[model samples]
Target: MSGTGDDFKWFGEGFDGFPKRLPEDVVEYIIFIINSKLSAIQTRERLQGFQRALATLEKKFLKEYIWQRESIRMDLVCDNRRWFLRGTTNYGDSVADEWLIVYFLRELSQEFPDAWIRIYDTDGEFLLIEAANAIPSWLTPEVAENRVWINNHHLCVIPVSDHDNPKSLAIEEALSIINDVPTKLQHLPKIEQEAFYRLKSFPSAISENQHHATLPIPRKLAYILRSNPSYIAPAVEAFYLRDPISLRLLQPEKSRTQLNFPPESFVSVSVRFTKVLYAQLLGQQWVPPGPYGEALAKLISKESGVPSVSREKAEIGIKVTAGFEMLAQHKLYADKKATREIQLLLEDIEAGDEALPSDDEIARWPKREDNEGWLDIDFVEFEKELAGKGAGSTTRGFGDKNAQDNLRKMVERFNKFIEDEDAGLDGAKGLGLDPMDIDNDSEAPPVGWEDPEDSDDSDDNEDDDEQADKEFEEYERTFEKFLTLSSAEKSALLDDARELAQVEEAEKEEDEEIKKLSEMMEAELFSHGALNLGAKKNSGVKPVMGDGEGRGKAKLEEFLEEVDDNDVEYLDEDYNLAENMLQAFKGQAGMAGPAGNLMSMMGICFPPDADTDEEFKNKNKDPVNNK
Candidate 1:
């Protein structure tokens, strides 16, 4: 790979052998992987696909693909506001390739110049699939409105991840922790391990028994190293295998190129280096060789206080800032063309050629004059007021204990959302003017609020359960019991039904005679002898009966009316023809063959009113096609 020109400046990582002129689909696929919109299985498959794509990436074309793909990523990092339009759930070949971005800019520059760009991707996968292939018009019902209004000063950047992705990188950073055998991650110092955990898997716990716990779970995991040194090596090894997020620390390798942050994710840098440094100090292979290893050595030496430097003055480690701090540090203002100016400033910083503005200068930037101060709204108080849980707590439907509990939970959930986004909200600083005071109602749902899609899903499942139970109860025996029956037992049931039906048939002397006569006549009339004599066989057309008429009586009357007795030279011929016609045309009043078969089977298997006196009697003498 050749070195890139000085014009392209990404010194830290991933721009070393940049590509040029590649397929847009490749870029889109990279974006999809970054979005982490796939399942554990899907993400694994996707990562494998990416690895294969990279492996097969014609060495000659590597430069263009890397450069173009990175360009899209850099543009996103440069201007957070453009992310207002998210990647839609349908993420096909739509990761907004260079040309796509250029086209979007062209569209905006020509028309809807003020439009905040939208870039949502789909399964194209959705924000979270409530079910298959359904992308919500809006991630949140409140956010669902077609329009998204982002103030120039405080554009929010929502971080997304593939919690289930299992791919890992085997770069210098990951490999340095071990030589060959057991892999000595145990010596990777507590301080170093703490830094990594805080960045990669912070705010998570194996189990949280305490309510309102401020998820310092990664810190807790870090604490384990200090508490028990022997466990560190095994834990780190297990973490690497179990947690996909740990891959963020490693360098860009085939099949693993998505970095977890901008140029300034200190925790990530610190953690990756800690492992390599631990091995370097121990005189191991130190496989990953790069400027990053040198930077880490310098950072550690500075922290440990060099030969002449005082330990007190040396930095302990890199400190990470909140999202709001990042916004303020950039010094963005809601002034005209602010996004472009901010991008330029960031680019300059990346180039190491621009000096940051002084504190006084940054204070002069726009401070969200029209924005709502997130702290002012109280969702819980509002819920209590609406439900009257306290003052008139017992006055209304709140009397139901379950109702009160539900309302309380809803309130807590809404409030918890505010707490989570507090960092972003801080960046949305008020210009000292009250937004609610200016307008009675704001369209926005409380910050970080999500639609109750889960609850709806549970309700749907419950409805299905109730319907299944109702149908199940209609059966004489449970399905399990039916399944347990032997073939002989099942056949014996048929024998009993057939015998009982035969007895009933014998009792129906008046109708049995007609039935037998019909059966005999059909055989004789359709015989080869009768056919050669030019005698007409039964037409097979069943006649319809008038209201309330018995099927047997109706069929007999129709046969008598249609009979050509004069044409039948013999009395026997006339009788046979009429009987055969009536019997052959005896139909189930309105059922197709399959339905009639099913009904008959069902009746025999699980007779209704089993002990009823008329058990063997026909219920539908004249059948109707129920379907």
Candidate 2:
């Protein structure tokens, strides 16, 4: 490992000796990984297949392979308004490879501001997860399946639920729907915009290409730490694991790399450090080293507003503390279960509940004995007021007697309406004849109508129509029971019956609609099959001589009719023969396979004798064969 030239020192002088070329297997693996990420950014075509491909790669390779290489390449192509990424790695290579990919993609985003580019690996979507809490309320996993996209390096959600359609079609339709609507970063929720900007600032080291670290470290790492200084914490943490002999790589004797930092400042710096640590743990190609530990000690002193410690003993402790805190933060975000638990805790806290309730606590919550007082209080004041209102309840005793008489008259009037419902008379209007008007008794049945013994025709009618008599008697008994209920109870029962009838009618209509749709689809399928069958059958039939174009039309109609009559039954027999014959005599048309062969074998197949045949032969002559 020799020092790289100044022009090639992307990772700075400290990383010059670091390996540039990875092992062949590792190179191949990283290339595949890079290509997979690029493929997702390129196009939405076969997106479901793309997801499956990524899953297969992760299952088969990711766990086994180590990303030791510090270089990567991309093969990109552009179609009309879209970029396509090929699964090859020939488009030159760059150092700080992973960041370089992000840099290049950001540049592409700037170039094609309208075009959406999605970049994701097995880790999940890069931009969406950062602003997960701020996504739209309607964005469920199913709705957001293929709608997550990036336009101009800003996260934009296409709010449509079209998971049933192909990914390509869904994307196209979604974009078209919102084509005229401008989506700006400022339009996003405050928290979401903040997240986007934070992520945007993380890649500034690569984008700006400037070094900011005060120590004599690699230029590449200097730029990265300059953009997000907390990244140095993870590097310092990794440096601690090295053996004493490996410390020689730091070149401590070099005057240019020397730095002094204090131990007490580590506390404040650790408190201010990023908890997510995405840049250090997931962004960078590798955990940087060399002078980063000492550099981080200096960072701690500066960030905490404490003066640097000159004592070597205090500086060592400060560096160690810095590394340990960085490692802790990195591990915290990396834990799978911690994120979910933290989210639940945050939700609880937001809802004014500091802790998640246990199952037993939840069960006991509603068992408070104080709630029993609610049952002791009377809430029937409205019902009492209602009973006092109207003409039936002016005074207690007199009103009660009038109510009983009115009820008897109302039942009689309702029964008469039911009998006249078969005629042009309206049941509702007939029942509205005012039961309180005692003088309007003309509509009521004659005296002794209720007594079977008083009617001479009752016995004769019962014997003549036994079943009708039983049904009428049953109806009368049910009506009597219905009349016994109070006004409120009767009203409630009628309302429930009306609602139930409405629900049943709606369900019946829906079922009928579904049945009709199914039948229509089946008919369409059958019709399409019939048309295809007619075409195939027509293809096998030769035109009759001298019948001209009109004859061909008649023959096609006849064949279509035949297909319609036979329907699916034709699939069993004529379909096979038609398919085979068409295939056997394809292109030749006039040459009827076995018949032509038999005629040729018998020596009866004459050469072209007619003028039309010779003219056809001359027109169809092969220039290559001159025949």
Candidate 3:
């Protein structure tokens, strides 16, 4: 491992071996030079003389320089049916080239379908960190350490008991695990798979020689990426995925409900490729290179009528695209939340709550003998029970309607209710109306004049009247006590009463509205029947002609028959007179004499006079008159 090019045996072909003998700081400095300076072909060419001198001094520098141009740094080996594609980081830094290797392995799996392609990085497990939660339970860190690989486009956790053993044992272990649980850990997670599919077309070559056109990204991000182009690949993939958390990183919260923030304010201030802004760029037919980003850029430019693309326009498009992505992510989160809530609800139902009535209890309830009766449902009691159970629970229950011949019984009850007016009288004091004023206005009897009972049997009737009078006196006393309260106390009590009344009034109004809504809904449900075919038995409009033409002819004939004969004769005479007058008027129009013209001017028709016609012709024949 001498400094001379020919003697540097440790620097193998394809830069497989590293400069292990070199000091750590020197190796790090060489890595930095390779990543920063040798990334582009032009830079490499310009530094060729310096690299040659450095290579002659320390040959490991040349190996690092050559490694920069290659896209994927990997070694391939095969044992029986298992194909091992081993990858390692270029220039001792795995972070710089891990994604490129992962993407290349995916492309390789698609290319070699039948082969058991087991791909892994020597430095770290592939995709295991990203999909740790999604992977199977058995894929523990210990089991997966140095054993995890992507097989057949799926994450396969193959445990190896000893690293010293051949690679075939690891393949056998994978096969055994697959046999036990075929679907476990051997499939890429849905979200991760989608991400790979979207980012599959990223430029595979890791070099600054190939210029990558700017993506529709934020200006700040663009600026950041200009310095660190290595971040571009991951950034593009993240943009495609449009995860809400990622999208919202630099976006400001929108004040959508603000009065001053009009809807038109959201209109792009510059040319943005908004028409093609979709979740996953679904509408674009554009591809990359020569016109690298030309198709999308041109389409967006044409849509906005702005001929050129600028960083501001690109930033706008990126912002809107992030909005679309955010909307999708929100919907996904909502759907997941709804699914979880429904699952919990189902579990609660299965667990069963004691407050709910059982099926047997509902079945044992009595049936109604007749319909059209008020259901025996104590809603107040039901509400109390529901409140006791808490808002988080609900249940099904039953009702009984056992009133027989309800309509007739309801009429009788109404009559009895109206006859017993004592209930109305009891509320008179509360209504600020004196009950005694409504009962009677006659003067009281003299103190010594007592009416003698007609018989002993009448004493009970008197006693009952006395009891009624005593009750009325007690009610009057209560009313007087209420009036004796101070004005302030009375006002306070009145206000309290008014509030209660207002509450009751509001409740009544609400109940009425609900009842009216229910009735309208019921009407709407039945209204559709009117629109059904043949629902209307007869159309009111009479037929113009057909078998139904004579349907109303009888009424016309009867009306004609009811007319007098004299009236018909008079109608005929009037018609003849009118015909004669019309003929005279027409004849007058045909007359050609002066008398006829005079009659026509007067609107009176006359027979042409022979003398007048000769007189007119003679007068017109004179030369002076003709001129």
Q: Of the candidates shown, which would achieve the greatest lDDT relative to the real structure?
A: 2
What lDDT tens digits, residue by residue, belong to model 1 across residues 489-596? 866876798899998878898688889976665455354132232334344322222222245346557666775758545534544444342332323233233323
- Listed in order, each prediction's TM-score against the native is 0.16, 0.22, 0.20
Give the RMSD in angstroms, all C-alphas superposed, for model 1: 30.3
Report backbone clashes per prediction.
Answer: 36, 1, 1
TM-score of 1: 0.16
Give one digit per residue, the lDDT tens place, for model 2 in 1-627: 112222343455455554243222221111111123345444444333333444443454233221222223334444455444433221111222333344444444544454455444332343444444445544433344335555565555565434543222233554454444534222355434633433343443332222111112222222233233434434443434444333333433632332222122232111112111212322222222444555555544564333443333234333443343333233433353333443444455458666433334433422111111211212132233334332344433322222233343344444554566443532243223334744665787677546756566787777779988888999988876886678679869988998999999999999999999767644544432421344443343432222233453466457657765547566434554433322333323464444234335655342322234345468668989987
The local distance difference test score of each candidate is: 0.31, 0.40, 0.38
> How do the residues 330-398 of candidate 3 rate in per-residue lDDT, one tens digit apiece?
434334332244234434544763123333543353322122112333343344333333123233221
Candidate 1 local lDDT, residue 614: 38
The reply for model 3, stretches above 4 Å from the true place, is 1-96, 145-147, 156-172, 175-185, 188-627
Which pairs of residues clash in candidate 3, taking residues 3 or more apart in a chain or in different chains? 289-292
What clash pairs does model 2 have?
12-219
